[model samples]
Target: MPPPQTTGIYPSDSITEVAQSLPLDPLGAGSADLLAGDVEYRLHLIIQEAKKFMVNGKRGTLMPEDVEYAMDALNVEPILIPPRPLPLPQFQALTIPSSSSHPQQIYHLPDDEIDFATYLKQPLPAGVANSSGVKWKAHWLAVEGVQPAIKENPNPTQRGASRPQPSSTSLRPQARTQLPQELQLYFTRLTTALVPPSPTGPETEPERHRLAALTSLRTDVAVAGILVYVVKWLGESIQKCLMAPTGTIGQLVDAVEALVGNEGVFLEPYVHILLPPLMSIILTVPLGPHPSSSSSNQPSPYDLRLHASQVLGKVAEKYGRSYPGLVPRLISTLSKSLNSPPFPSPLGASNPPSGRYEGSLLALSCLGKQAVKSTVWGKAGENISRIDDLAGRLYTDGGGKKRNPLIRALIKCLSVIINPKPVDITPQANLDDVSEAFGPNLANMLNKKLWTASEILRLRREELEGEGEGGGVDGMEVDQA
Candidate 1:
């Protein structure tokens, strides 16, 4: 047999083929064998070096980058490979007829070259803005020993600051009493804007500043740090303004509205804290110092009560579904105010004002139709008797000198509760029927619109009953009668 052939992973035939690819003649069998051994040894050495990189990097697999690093470390020229194409081109083979009646097979990766001019003429792909290329930006990691008020920073209320370790001698963690400097500055600006040194003139600098501050409270997302403190301040301010001997509660009402309307700050958790101040404003007997008995023309802070009621309504509308008991609690508080007797100065409280009753009624109306039926028109009709008693008292108190807002509000409540549909045929309103339904004092003050609507609704209900078609008619149509 021929001299025992060397058995190795890389065959001498592959080395011969590689040499044929270059500008050199085909190697002799012995020369090819020797060259293949050297090539095989070099590959083994490079792989052994690459394996070290993989182990150091704590990787199970040796990546191509590791091989490149190995080549650089060993001062060996690395083989250059082009980036992978979308769908990699398949390897193609070509055959050439040789003179010895045998064919030579050649394999290669084919490239389809394009002219530079043609490449330039073609429309380029649209590029996205700031999508490609490396870029960097600087953002605050911390400022003045506190995280900056930025989207990157967590809310102080939610992800609270880490507490410091207690000393070995003590077991309790020290509580932080002072607020952050940023929060202190913000609170000062807000309070100053809301309560200027002098009264805010109409469309003046102070007015603009006040408006701007309210707008910030309504829209700013950075108020989380001072939110609890701000709410506490608002509660105290509202109570003081309502209890003050003089001045309108407009500013306090506006501030409360802004705080409640803020989408950024969650107020539901603090609803208990908020409710007392709002209820006091809505139901307090005298919002400002009792308008002196001599000054009968003084304006009642009735409008302020209406404003507070509106804010209360908003709170209910926003959070009612989440807290199912909210509406009922509000109705209960308002019912107490509406049913309260007018004359007494209950020990510590001032004489109850007529405007308190008006505010209660409007507040009930604000809670929508279902609330009206529940409170104004009760399931057993007990509230109706109570309202009649109230109407009589209000009429007696006014003594026909001026229209008590309470009576006007009661009439409005009656119209709202009835919610009558329009009638085509004109029918006379029998005051006798109205008087029988709602006591004489209330019936006397019923406007023509309310009388017509109530009579039509009553007539419709009677017609439905006569037709034997009712357990309370729908829309209560009375045209046939």
Candidate 2:
């Protein structure tokens, strides 16, 4: 007769065999040491799983249900099951440092221990001589200690101007008061870079991955630097970008994007300071043709139009709520784009030409979708009406035909804004009007297509729980080999 299936044993003995083969006491260590090692390994695994859950927007404790689903989906036996940890608490609480304390402590190595000149001369990646990483690290070290070389320089005025001067007092109370601003700046830049760009051009997967990593690092540093200087610097940079003429805007936007992408680690610490001001500029920049056209023959303002669209799209994704003033400008821009003249289509006569106007229209639609639930929009109240007008203009009779890709993209954006779902409820005034205008077709599409990480996890958990209750026979099953 076959072994009782109720033993919770599988027909395959492979798992049991591997378990038996693991070192019982190969190092001659006692059970205490072995148990400690096992606990550590289990903790690491738990942390990893928690990270995945957090990425999927699952907040709070790792319930048995979450663990079971994670194990089944990942096709692995978790080292320790949920509820096994006697003091099992929310993973986020453990992983994230408290606001009262520093997330990371700066370690200052004595100047004599490492020669800065020699360190700078070491072999580096090609084309990295001017890399921001090198400069940022040097700056960090110089500022970390009380008696840093920069501080002890003979010319006090020159030294102070070249680098961030340390606080005169070593009082813990004073340091604590000053840290939050510095940290905010660092996080702002990091978040901006981390936000995935909308599909605008042909970029390979590897390039995308590289950009994400760079942004993540920059955000970390920016978060750390949350100081007045960082905030001011960020604000000034954004102002310059906003004030730039159409002829120069494209180059400026490109420079900001490139810097954020390449030196993410170096910039991470300044994100908080940089983000708010950058967002302000993006929101407030005047839309439409340049104040004064340089010449009728100058590249038709296509490059500026494209760059502006791309920058606004990025800003909307990252900092939509911080600058209420920008929403009207965004709606105005899209309205103009939809009304602009047609250009030659990219995909031949089969599709309508997607000119700078179309691109801007699509970008504006994306921005509105992002801002649907933003606090700024809620406060402004009138912006939603403007968004509705833009939406109506794009899809209604006075607007062009509805079958184009540009139209489809606009519809998708409106759907997202009108029904952001679990993340945010559509405002009643906008919802009633938008729903009536778009009717059941657009509403159904939005409801069917929208899927956030939290929603996905909920579905997976439900499926797994259903299987567990049915003796594992009712659902598809997988086990680690």
Candidate 3:
């Protein structure tokens, strides 16, 4: 028995038109119809085979590569195929008149023209590096409702020790084992709450966290166990944020300030660790990349220096008497920064950034009037005189802006030399004496009032000595009479 024939879903006229495109005679309607049916049957067979490959590959969708594999399996010629997922060419339409007196638009891909000379001359583009493989690091997410004592977790507020008095020495060995689980949880949450999730701008949330952290540092007595850890963390954080943006550096400095202000912490033991980072912020040249002069919206690097200097002043004032060497060491450091030659001698070489010099001056002024008097009128005064000369030259060199910060710093230092209440017996001195004492260049920078102040500060010791001698002479005469 013969089976019924299946009809071709594709149009026979389309098949005839395609045949006309070949270098052969036109096809008759019956031949075109037979060819269309055979072509449609072959297409269906290829698709069915492609689906088998797709099913075997565990993909429900039949990809172009599956079709290629299917053609190979069927022992049939496949069309030219590029790699899968490559970019395809754009299609253009062409209009042609058909036998039905209507124009038909056939879509075809256009060829891309290449210039071999340019292509050969150009360097091959760089291929992307393969990404690092997936990685896993083991850390406890939580242990019995308490966070682990590890770097991955926030440091606990109160570390435990076996001894009655919890010292840093005792806390280190038993930090993990001795902490109560409840205290461990509280420490984790407290530290977590101290840091804002996003510390980008001057947002309210970060400010709140910052204030809260500072308050806790100043007022919380129970945090004594973790005092050592907090100091270490603050030092590390300040070092890390040295090259950070404005708000970031300021944030860490505020933390340090709060720690210094914490009366209960007894920070003298850790001052060695804490002081260097603060000094670095104060003395490091170009504390991170500065924004361009046109970018006035952001705070300049000097503001951070000023704030750090204030904190440094507090540290010195609080500990100066106990550690007499502290003030001298600070002065020595600032002197080194000042002693560097102001001008770059070599043509291509450059002087240190003026910001460093300014910071040194500001820090010196913060020490005390005696420190300022020594730097101005004592042997170290030579450096300030040289800086004054440099400032003058810089002003005449056509960029006065370069000298402005240094001049401001010097002015602030001079302003600090005056006593709050002037003594009537103090000798009066004019600008000539001031010029001879502080150099003519620095003298010109000062006003008459500063000159008087400088003189009072300079002659204060002499006046007191003369008074003591005269009083002794009068007492000796009265006893003899």
TM, every model:
0.52, 0.26, 0.50
Q: What is candidate 3's lDDT per residue for 1-481, written digit by digit as tens?
A: 4433447687878888888888888775378778878888898999998887788789988888879877855546677777757887688999987888788999998888999778666644444223354233468966644466677765433222221111122223224443666545545544454444444444677667667777887787756666655666667666765545555567667778887888877788778778898888887765643332334443577777888888899999999998989999999888887766654321122443566777887888888887787774354244456776766654554323334667667767766766554565544556676566455555655554564436543655565677799899999999999
lDDT for each residue of candidate 2 in 238-338, tens digit (9 for 90 to 100):
45434333433343345355445433334433444444543343333232132334654322333444454565566545544665655666666555544
- Winner by lDDT between candidate 2 and candidate 1: 1
Badly placed stretches (over 4 Å) of model 1 are: 1-178, 245-247, 292-299, 340-343, 346-355, 379-382, 395-402, 415-428, 451-481
Candidate 3: minimum summed lDDT over ten consecutive residues — where? 161-170
Give the Å error, residue 59, model 2.
Answer: 54
Local distance difference test scores for all models: 0.67, 0.42, 0.66
Instruction: Residues 1-481, candidate 1: write the lDDT tens digits.
Output: 3534666788988887788899997675578777777888999999998887788779999888779877755546777755655576688999988988778999898988999778756654555334675334468876543456677766433343332111121111111123566667787788778655455556899889988999988899877667766776777777766644222366767887898889988777677778898888877765565322233333356666667778988989999999999989999989887766675432223333466787888788778777777777664334655776675664555423145566556555655656464566554566666666555555566545555436534744565566565544633665445
Q: What are the candidates' C-alpha RMSDs?
A: 30.8, 25.8, 32.1
Compute the lDDT of residue 205 as modeled in candidate 1.
97
TM-score top scorer = 1
Regarding TM-score, does 2 or 3 come out ahead?
3
RMSD of 3: 32.1
